[model samples]
Target: MTQGLAAAGCEVTLLLKAPVKTDRLVAPLTGVPGVTLRRPYEEELLPDLGPRGLTPDQAVGLITRLDTENRFDLVVVRGRRAAIAAAQAEALAGRLWTYLTDVPQNVAELTSAAVSELTDIAVASRFLLCQTEELRDFLESSVPAACGKSVLFPPVVVVPEGVAGSGTPHTPLKLVYTGKFAPRWNTLEMTELPAALAAQGVPAELHMIGDKIHRDSPDWAKRMAKALEDTPDLVWHGGQSRAEALRLSAQCDIGLSWRAPEMDASLELSTKVLELGALGLPVVLNRTPMHEELLGADYPLYAGEDIDSVADVLALAADPDVYRRAAERCAAASAKFTLDRAAERLRGYLDLAFPAAPAGTSPDRPLRVVVAGHDLKFFTRLADHLMSLPGLEVRLDEWEALRTHDQYRSKELAAWADVVICEWCGPNALFYAQHKRPGQRLLVRLHRFELYAEWPRKLDIDKVDAVICVSPYYADLTRERVGWPADKIVVLPNWVDDEQLDRPKLAGAEYTLGMIGIAPSRKRIDRGLDVLAALRRRDPRYTLVVKTKQPWDYWWIWNRPEEREYYERTYRRIQRSDLLADGVVFDPFGPDVATWLRRIGFVISTSDDESFHLAPAEGAASGGVPAVLAWPGADTIYSRRWVHEDTDAMADAIHRIVSEGRFDAARAAARAEITEHYALRRVCQLWTDLVVDGTAPERIQLDRFAAVGLG
Candidate 1:
């Protein structure tokens, strides 16, 4: 919604509920014009209510203060309290347009009563609009008719937030469903839709968003787990803000409009459908009279009564032209129901509700905002970059330094920061829980190390506003093992500053193979040794140069006696032999690895599992042939099919590198490709967009963050 309004030339100020340190909401929205964010001081106005629960009085106070300070043109309510608050603010301001993203049924009766006071009630779908109708009718019949004067606009569609006019339609039949996975609305039913499609040989996937509903219902959660187990095509995720949800939905070829068979549901249309259509995604909606009536004959596929019909629709949607025409029709229909159009229609109603302000008003300067987080080095760099922009002040809170200065722990440091970025391996959730402030955006970067450790189990993902992963692979692993919403996860691959590592690629170094980093178990030093052995066995001219930090026991092992011995006997030998040999060399000093990688001809990784093998990525970036073992976790976590395994295949790859003499061209091409995807500029841009704008692109949401919660 922010992006859509920003694209339409509206300056945006996002009032987050909590601190945003990670790129969950901002990275995807960066580079977009006309949007600015403000990190307001968040205060917990209602202590009795938890994060999801807010009372009418508390809601009114928050909205009134925010509106008084900024006077927004349109106020969008996401959760229940937010809706009520927006409505109250609209009533007070007497001219603010209001839109609700969630189903009205989810809100408390009292909160709903407050929202009914708004000038206009906007829903995402015809189904929801009807649901609003039922609630209105009930309220009117129960109360006085004079109390119900709100207008209902069913199914207002907006372009998927952060997606620009790409000119080409989305391909590959990708379908995404963004919502909570509660039983009342049959959320889990869609979880099985993907596997059902795959079973019938229809290529399709269902990306589930939002937190697991019935979380306390062990039987239901377990059944949901079992149902989605081994469903490779199904990507389950948890709750996310509307901005993050739409950003993710934009990457799909189609948007799913499937809801449970509720009388109220039949009258609603999903926000996903509107977003997908706005982003040029064709849609497959459940057959409902309103959908049929609004969409007319242009409805490409309809799952009338059976879930199996979804597969049939998906199979037909695979054709590019078929999907394109459907998307075009949906887009044409969506423009009629956009927030801009809705706000225009609602202006008169709003004017009637409240008196107008004095004329000749000047807009306030873009909100001066600051975001703070952990890893001072990274966030400092980010802060520096963001500070270069106009009307923005970015700060970095180094908890370690703060402790030195004031003897305060992580909690104290977080309380002083607006946006907190904690290391995935650090005490993120604990600090946030201890010193949480309302309107502070909590962003956490889930690095590769945490994915393999018990940290994920310990972390409270629900408290986190967004998580930035270095790769989609790690994000998927975290989602599968940890159960985080894909929308809340953003994949911002590691950034290497090309200018800093601009040393020329080494010439005539074809025989030198390099392996960087010091990890043994996961890095699989044994595989690199085996590759070296194979190369030497083939020709004595072949040699290996490994740069791993020493002492091997200190650096690689976890202080276990047996583990230390294993490292000393196996990995240390490779390191020691290479160091002692005249031709083979090993440098365990803390020198720059990128410069060394340029001097080597190839890089190898024999890992059991990797979120993303950074060594190989760096090696490839430095103009080396990358030979990586097809790791295990990718298949279960991300449905990966790009690994090359057999020992012979490894040897064959090595032989091709040596015999073909195509190393230079291959190296250049590999460098170009990896740099384009993982360069520091590109990666930082992703972070900036996600952190600054609070939008997570669909591809990053799906491929990186698999699902929310510990599934």
Candidate 2:
């Protein structure tokens, strides 16, 4: 969508997560006309911030900053939380218009947050548009009322991500299934269909991508392997990279989408169905309401209750002419979901949401700002600061907690904002680019973690405007890694409130050492354990107290058995061992920083990398001595320059703090230093100068009230 908008002559800015790298998605967007992409949090760049998860406070603050940064014509979103974030950001910017993707039925009852965030809803089919009425009526009855317009249009189709047309036919029929292999997808169940086809002497093969089953499930891979064991021709290809998967699928003669009878499965239409059909492959799908609604009754090859029925359908599909006809129908159906058509619908919707600017008129209103991202602390502080600025009004926008409760639906609060701020890069960065408000500023803060992962590989960076980085180290790392222009990058370290640092130190606090936030990999808590072991060897009187909330394993998405086992074993050992003689303590729920400071003598940051060391800095403010190891990227322009690489230096620093009994004085001094540097008022002034004086002149704002009712 970002590329499509760029093609339509709109200036695009893309904000993405940390650790940005080269991939297929970035290739097209780079060098695309009128597009500027910025990823602020690439992991390789910033090593002070830990993990990618965001608190509600941080998300709101990020949106506020982005909204104040640049002007955008419209906001389009693909997911519910993203839409809501965009809407809230838009409301802050006082701009309106948002585009939503996905059919209503595809939204789970649990994920209605997307629908609620939209100023205007958009669907891929006229069929889906018709369903919007049912949604509207539900919204009016279920909630208080429904506002905004809902329109149906075609799905936005892109050139195949990995597959290209084979342009040649093979004798043996190849059947391909692409998409995440979750329980709802029932890919394992469909193994029977392929085995049955092979048994019946039909030249059929099943290829599956994205196996999501637990690796520990002994029967997981065994079930499929057993089904195809007898038939050497029946192949169960393991998960493949997106490009490899697409290339392999394009070589096939038939595409398949099989769903179990689960409620979520029955209602949602897989993107595979659309992509395969778009690629001119005949799709054989299970009979479900979603399929019927999407393909219509005339659509052929709906599998019945058993594998036998699917096998029979495969046999019939092997005929050349029958296959050809199906392929033609798929091609025709695909045209209805082209990116151009989706863009046109969005354009029309925007036309209705915001009327054209009057001839010879200039927009003089303060540019509205909105920000979105997962970091709550950074944003909360940032928002507080932005709100204090003279010519700007900043409102924090939070979507995670709301989305967790609301599902993916529409949001009523986002109709008023102007600009949006976000932690530019992550798994869901694309969601923001798709659902931007018309004529609003889109500012994105890039952190370090996104730079090294596959998540940013999928972002269309050309969609974002100015990107704010926490440090020069992060900025340099992002440019080198993602190849974004340096001019678009701005350095803005995360700020905090001084009042929040006023707690007193507790007696005997010298016995405790603290570490904050979660995510086992980034925090390198295991490494911290290693340090604890070393510390115990040096002094038996030392003890460790670690505070962290529930790990990601508690969430269904990361609930793999291996992950669960690792966390459990690690926790048990940490609880049972007496390496330091004084024993270890685990506080699943710790008091806020002020209270925690009273009990902690020193704070330890053993993180592998970070965008900003918020915990250590906060601990310093609370009077805990800061002991930070040199992060891997500390030598770069993006990391904090304070990191020391010498282990002896680090150990000595800890020893000095512990032996001197200077905890109270250190805490008081550290608090004073941080409070002055990161105070909310100081940061807000910087944001105001950047938003109003930096990018305000380039904005092209349309008069929403004047242009309403014109589409």
Q: Residues 1-711, candidate 1, lDDT per residue (tens digit)?
A: 565556445677655554454666566566667666544333454446445444545555666676778776555444544544544443554333344334334334436445454223322111111223434333333323212133454455645446733434333346677765556556666666767767777666677676645676788887776655556677765567666677667655677776656633432456666666777666777666556655775578666556777677777777667766777887876776776775554443333332232122112443233343344554544554555444344444454431232225444556665556665445544556456677777777776665677766776767778887766667777788888888877766666554334334544567787777646555666666777777777777776787876444464375666656656676556656743244456775443454455567777767777776666656667676666677854332221211346555766677676787776776675566557666665665565566555666444322332221111
The lDDT leader among the candidates is 1
For candidate 1, the C-alpha RMSD (Å) to the true structure equals 27.1
TM-score of each: 0.43, 0.44
Root-mean-square deviation of every model: 27.1, 26.5
Writing each residue's lDDT as its tens digit, candidate 2 over 1-711 gives 676666544677665543344464566677788877665464232334446543333443454556567745444444444544544443443332333333344434524453443323221111112122233333322222122123343345675554555533356778888765444566666766656877788766676665445445576656645654454455656666555666777888888775655533432345577777777788887766456656766667787666787888888888777787777777677677777776675565444333433222235654455555545554664564455333455555554641232213213213455666665465334555556566655566766766787655566666666777776677777888878877777776666534334444555677677777655555666656766666676776566777776577347524766656666766776777778334566666443444445577767788777776777766766666666778754433112222455545555556555667655555565555556555544555466556654532122122321222101
Number of the top-ranking candidate, with TM-score as the measure: 2
